[model samples]
Target: MSEHDFHVHGPHDHELEHAAQHEPKGFAGQLAVITAILATVGAFFSYMGGATQANAALLKNEAAIRKTEASNQWNYYQSKGNKQNMAELAAELVSSEEQRTKYRDKVARYDKEKADIKLKAEALEAASAQADEESAHQMHLHHRWAQATTALQVAIALAAIALLTRRRWMEWGTLAMGGVGVVLGGMAWLQL
Candidate 1:
């Protein structure tokens, strides 16, 4: 048979399909339903964690870019200041009034340019700071999502264990963990 004509299953796939078809009753059925729900919740949490992590990374990159821009503006401001100082010194040394006035005009122009550059640099710095704050918040949310996902995974594992061991305590443990996972997920959603 051609490769396209064949089908393959992972180690647990056959058993999973069988379980789906059989649909266990009573306690096992309840455990199965809870496990399915937990799995779904875990998937959502995992997705949110990844999305938040990506947002954090993107915001951090934006912050870095803004910081670089601010640094460049500061450098420009410094250069303008240096030019103004040179013009001031030239104005003092020039004997002719016309030459002195020209140098003074240059000094004034440089001063104005420096002021504009400083303002731009300060604004960029503020923008960078804001981006950094946003990135940190996203990272915090990502961590919360990760925690929720972990708890749900643990709950799913407990459900499997309870199903195999037929232990009442394990079932309770699974429910407790599931509740914790859901609560964490809610907290993450609320950004608390």
Candidate 2:
């Protein structure tokens, strides 16, 4: 070969250019970008799942505390009942009219107090039940978010495999998994 022809045609450019042309057409690169986006979405779903679980736990604790308070109030009601019974028995045994009147007055006060305590305890127990219901609802929400996160993670894995294998079927698999993730996330968002 002539020196002029050698200078015009370099060895490095043609071989590399030929190989570059044979590579897949931007499929892996696009898949990589999509996988990254899906991973970000997965993180969001994971965060929501964890947060909802924590909220549910907090609500459950609140319910327990309210229940304990109700129990304490009921015990107080029992003590008040015992006091009223004792006063009625003493009034029966007393000879002085004034002493009997005083004991009767005490019975009335104790009865009124017990009625208020019973009402308050019942209200607190109802509130505890409501909190338990709310906690269960939050737990359901958490489960939905967890399912969405799992689907998203699977989609991300499928996308990575699609990028590595460059198989069109794998791309479809990734799309299907991503669709499932999106549907689950929508259900969570709608609280359904």
TM-score of each: 0.87, 0.88
Model 1 C-alpha lDDT per residue in residues 1-192, reported as the tens digit of each score: 687797789879999777667644467888989999999989999999999999999999999999999999999998888989999999999999999999999999998998899999999999999999999999999999999999999999999999887787899999999999999999999999
Candidate 1 colliding pairs: none
lDDT of each: 0.94, 0.91
Per TM-score, the best of the predicted structures is 2
Each prediction's total of clashing residue pairs, residues at least 3 apart in sequence or on different chains, is 0, 0
Candidate 2 TM-score to native: 0.88
TM accuracy, model 1: 0.87
What is the clash count of model 1? 0
Location of the lowest summed lDDT over 10 successive residues in candidate 1: 18-27
Q: What is the lDDT of residue 41 in candidate 2?
A: 87
Top lDDT model: 1
